[model samples]
Target: MSPLDQLFSNYLPVFLGTGIGAILVISALVGSRLLAPYSEERNKGTTYECGMLPIRRASTNVGMRFYLYAILFIVFDVEAVFIFPWALSYLAVGPQAYWEMVVFVGILAVGLAYAWKKGALRWQ
Candidate 1:
């Protein structure tokens, strides 16, 4: 068989399975919409927050600082997560892996230092 045929033979089952799954999901969504009861109640369209009646408009101005803090937390948190798997296999990976991780950490440290210098870490 040719290379394309070999490739298809190897992954044909996976492609078929994925196609079947997509078809089933689409059918289920369409079936639910067609078979389920439709409601036209006005209250159903209203904004509900924590089971309490909304007092004012939902779109309110929020401080950019909150988003900055969240993004910084995510970046550092993801970096911390990479350390765990590296630590587990460090012995096998040896000195190369160690130096790579050190470089990665140093880059993150520079980013943190820059943020600190710019007062992004300040709560204000």
Candidate 2:
């Protein structure tokens, strides 16, 4: 086969799949827009909370500590995720991988220590 034919053959499925996926997404969006209910009442756009009438502005002051805790949680959660795959493949990948993971964990521990020292881990 010619190079052009070979290239077309290799990428035909990818192009077809992308076109199909796009069509599906566009159809779903159009269907929803056409079939979903629409209302223009003032109450329809108001802030809703637990089926109760909102007494105050919806936006409120959130403490910086909440963000700090969330970031720390995400960091440690991702570390655990990485550790699981490494743990499963440790023996096959040998001592180099083990030492690499040890170094990774050591870095995370140092970060945790630093955060502790800076009072980022304090609850109150």
Query: What overall lDDT goes with each candidate model?
Result: 0.93, 0.93
In order of appearance, the predictions have TM-scores of 0.53, 0.54
lDDT of 1 by residue, 1-124 (tens): 9999999899998989999999999999999999999989978987868888898897799889999899889999999999999999988979999999999999999999999999999988
Positional deviation of residue 37's Cα in model 2 after best superposition, in angstroms: 22
lDDT of 1 at 40: 100
Show model 1 residue runs off by greater than 4 Å: 1-55
Clashes of 1: 0
Query: 1-124 in candidate 2: lDDT tens per residue?
Result: 9999999999999999999999999999999999998878987887768888888885798989999999999999999999999989999989999999999999999999999999998988
